[model samples]
Target: LVTIVAVNQTGGDIPLSQLYAPNSKIPASGSANLTDYNRVEEILGDTSDLGRGATLEYHPDPNLLVAKTKDAPSATLDCSVGVVAGGTSDIPIAEEARIIAAESGLDVVRAYDVGVAGLHRLFPPLKEMILRDVDLLIVVAGMEGALPSVVKGLIDVPVIGVPTSVGYGYRGGESALIAMLNSCVPGLLVTNIDNGFGAAAAAYAICSRMMKKREE
Candidate 1:
């Protein structure tokens, strides 16, 4: 028999001692006692089939804890650290963020091409960096300039948006900059278009503040 189960590891134990199926939407806090085991298989259908063993994928749930790797980094840090994530337009932003961070003597984690177009691609790496306890997140996106806003909504850390000139025509970069400036997400920051270095500088400043706060 092939069975799939979802366990919440955020709180150190699964609430109500229950496991959810992949299709289940786990609430932040709740109790669901699924009585029919066959229903899960029906939902998964032939998708769970593997050559000889079952494959399990971990999908994040806002309400429940997703299992983290054993060797995951703790949320405490020794120095200023940040993560630079890019989407769609990947040429210079991620690289520039790393360079700026390094020059400023800060640790930087880079995740490339995690734009909203392939939305799910960004979460895992983002989560990993969060686990590593980064002090800030810099999201570089061109075209629509939406990735930063999306990331800010999911994470509590400060997000600096770097809009690049990856689109065609003069209007392309301007439009992206406008979109970033007009982002409705509260406390979101927008740097000048194609300004990865500026974003990293802001991140370093934030890290400096964090260090000061920790010392206080």
Candidate 2:
């Protein structure tokens, strides 16, 4: 049982006090704002009552949830890919890439905080990933943007470089993006600065083509 909470940004967290039945003083005819509606906890009871285990899926909007789930199964079997982030600051961009790939019906393996500053940290998993034959790789980095180049040198597979906007001072993210764009190695592709979603989309397209060729 997963409890998912979706709240309107403008409407603050609902207070516990306003959940009761309105009396004459409060006027039951008054508009009930979602902002005023406080805490909601779903109590999942034992499955014995219904002859099955309790697996309650709650959606804030029932119609949208139903439509989404109906298409989810068929949409989830398209591609297998890997996402490697250079550092902790790059995790958000990496996560965004993972989310985009997953939503596009791809399986994603996340390798995080393995930047080029610590060269030894990147080799083992990278070698293993290359051996396992991931269809495509998304290399996410910020500062120097050297991870993609290193990985490109190590493997023959296509690598898409993602430069995050996490650098400081005069260098800004432009320095990292330029570094990636200027990579001397071959088979290294690049997206705009901090464009994780775009990088993931490009990887998905590449994997999809590979899958199609495999099927043929």
Candidate 3:
């Protein structure tokens, strides 16, 4: 019969021979032996796993971590960015946000085509994100730009409003800009019209600060 000895170590498993005498004896079956056991115990006495520094060091893949670290600010904790768009036409702006966030080493999730006109589409993905606890939210919309206001009302997290120039007719893009500027929700922030990169950068700043605070 083979006996197993369990030792907790990080980075990978370490053989018993690495830590103990190689000439150690094995007990025979049915023998009430304490002689060999005592010797082993004495060698490892008073040394718990913690005391022995037996911990698994999680080293993220060098290539993956390096790529992310190259872009991210020198911070330890992970930050997340959530981007939402009002309609299909607004996707380009939302894509801009995603690209910027990704370049900055922030994990990004996208919720698209959830404009206020289709309220139901908004909540399912939005609710999922809220439950997942995103670090920041970017709301992109045009043609009245009411989506951000609605989002601000629904969630307490910081929302950066991006007014896309997707509208036409006499209202022009002015309607979107005015709607966002006049939003009733307190603490709702607005960026330049169609400036997805700016919105993403702002969100990255907020999330990076949060990560730094957590480390402190």
* Prediction RMSDs, each to the true structure: 16.4, 13.1, 20.2
Candidate 3's C-alpha runs over 4 A off are: 1-77, 169-172
Q: Rank the candidates by TM-score, best first.
A: 2, 3, 1
- TM-score per prediction, in order, is 0.60, 0.65, 0.64
**In model 3, what lDDT does residue 208 have?**
66
lDDT comparison, 1 vs 2, better candidate? 2
Compose the digit string of candidate 3's lDDT tens values, residues 139-201: 999988999999989988889999888856125557887888998898789998877766866
The candidate that wins on lDDT is 3
Candidate 1's displacement at residue 20, Å, is: 59
* lDDT (CA) per prediction: 0.58, 0.61, 0.62
Query: Against the correct fold, how does model 3 do in TM-score?
Result: 0.64
**TM-score of model 2 vs. true structure:** 0.65
Q: Extract clashing residue pairs from model 3.
A: 10-55, 10-56
**Shift of residue 141 alpha carbon in model 3, Å:** 0.2
Model 1 per-residue lDDT tens digits across residues 1-216: 112222222322222223455455433332121222334445345433222223323221111112223332223224545554555445466666655454344677778878777888988888888898877787877887788888888888788888888865257577778887898898789988776656765776677566668789
